[model samples]
Target: MDRLIEAIEDKQNPSVVGLDPTPALVPVQVMDAYHIEADEYVEDDDDNLAATGAAAAYFEYNRAIIDAVADIVPAVKPQIAMYEALGPAGVDCYTMTCQYAREQGLYVIGDVKRGDIGSTAAAYAKHLSGFDGADVWHEDAITINPYLGSDGIEPFTAAAGETDRDLFILVRTSNPSSAQIQELELADGARVYEHVADLVEQWGADTIGRFGYARTGAVVGATHPEEGAALRARMPHTFFLVPGYGAQGGTAQSVAGMFDRDGSGAIVNSSRGIIGAWRDDPRYSETLEAQTALDLVAANARAAAEDMRDQLRVALA
Candidate 1:
């Protein structure tokens, strides 16, 4: 938690670029550039070649985004599901992306959202605590699912403590369907998310860092401004990983309350808005060379990240 806080303070930006790239988000020229190599590797397997090519393009795209915004933003949230969609090749791309982001000195937040109990949970915790002393994942923090209760979360917290990493538990998420479970009222007259928030605070009680935030943070979506603000008061020791910004319709004004008085405590994330910025650029053309297209991606991403930071600065002020 301290490390992350320091990075955010250093950059003076509480925003995290989400490296959740999909096929549609990537430039067609970039994807096409890898088809020949993918074909060579897959050798007659069309499906494998397509996946391999997509995975390759995604890594290049991620690299461009990381290189563009590494200095402007403190962290990056790479949604694992986006990589997993392409199977093993995509998983490799995800790890490569994390490694690349970290190499550029940006904190990598693996948006895995994993949940399970006992051994399975411990295995997932390995993302923070690398197996055999190798830090394969290269993530500084990760998102977790709390539906499985303490058993599901304890392993991650323990790993975080041991590794000096952090975890953000799902609380009030950004997606509309999240309310189906998180907003349900319990017998004690508290919403499910509120109860979960208390547990998240408790989970990190012993791990509070110099900045007054615990390693166990909460995932409070930026979309719910009122609730997010209230949670800031309720979970005093808990930091926040706020999502649902940009492409999901969350703005700086919508998420301003999630931060503490000093404009700390939360890091907002924007996926498509930053990485897909090139799509809206009139200069983009499908016929452009891959490197040229990627150059546009890098330029657009940097501009978008800068715009987001400026917007947040105004809102927080």
Candidate 2:
């Protein structure tokens, strides 16, 4: 948590770029360029060739974005599901992306959202701890699911302490359907998320860093401005990993209150809005060469990240 906070302070940007890529988000030209390599390596395995090629393309797309925004943003969050969809090849791509982001001096947050109990939870904690002393996953932090209770979360907290990493527990999410569970009213009149917020604060109580935030942070959606504001006040010690900006309709103003009075305490995330910015550029053409399209992708991503940073500065101001 201290490391992440310091990185954020150094950049003067309380924002993170989400490195979530999909076939639709990546340029077809770039995808086509990797087919030959995939075909050569995955020969005779018709079932795996397409997925392998797509995964390769996704990595290149991610690398372009990371190289573009590594200096402007403090962190890069690669949602695992995007890579996991491509099967084993995609998982490898996900780890490679994390390693690359870390190499570029950016904090890598694995948006894994893993949850379980006991030893199973311990296995998931390996994302932070690594295997046999080797940093396999290369994540500085990860998102966790807390529905399974303390047993599901304690292992991660322990691993974070041992590895000097951090975790953000899902409390209030950005998706529309999140309300179906997160907003449920308990008998005590507090919504489920509020209770989760309280627990999150407690979970990190023993692990507060130099910035007065816990190693265990909370995932609060940027879409619910009022709720986000209230959560800021309610969970003073819990830092926030806020999603739903840009493509998800979360404006800077909508998320401003999630920050502390000093403009700290939260890091907002933008995925498609940054990585997929090339799609909205009129100059981008499908007929362009693969490297040319990638160059365009990098330029658009950098511009979008810069714009997002400026918007946050103004909103916080």
For this target, which candidate reaches the highest lDDT against the unseen true structure?
2
For 29-105, candidate 2 gives per-residue lDDT tens digits of 99988977898877575888888999999999999999999888999999999999999999999999999999999
Query: What residue runs in model 1 are displaced by over 4 Å at the alpha carbon?
Result: 43-46
Question: 1-317 in candidate 1: lDDT tens per residue?
Answer: 99999999999999999998898999988988887778777756476888899999999999988988998999999999999999999999999999999999999999999999877999999999999999989999999999889988889999999999999999999998989999999999999999999999998899999999999999999889999999999999999999999989899999999999999999999999999999999999999999999999999999999999999999999
Alpha-carbon error at 27 in model 1, in Å? 0.5
TM-score of each model, paired residue for residue: 0.98, 0.99
Error of 2 at 215 (Å): 0.3
Give stretches of model 2 more than 4 Å off: none
**Clashing residue pairs, backbone N/CA/C < 3 A, model 1:** none
Give Cα-based local distance difference scores for all models: 0.93, 0.95
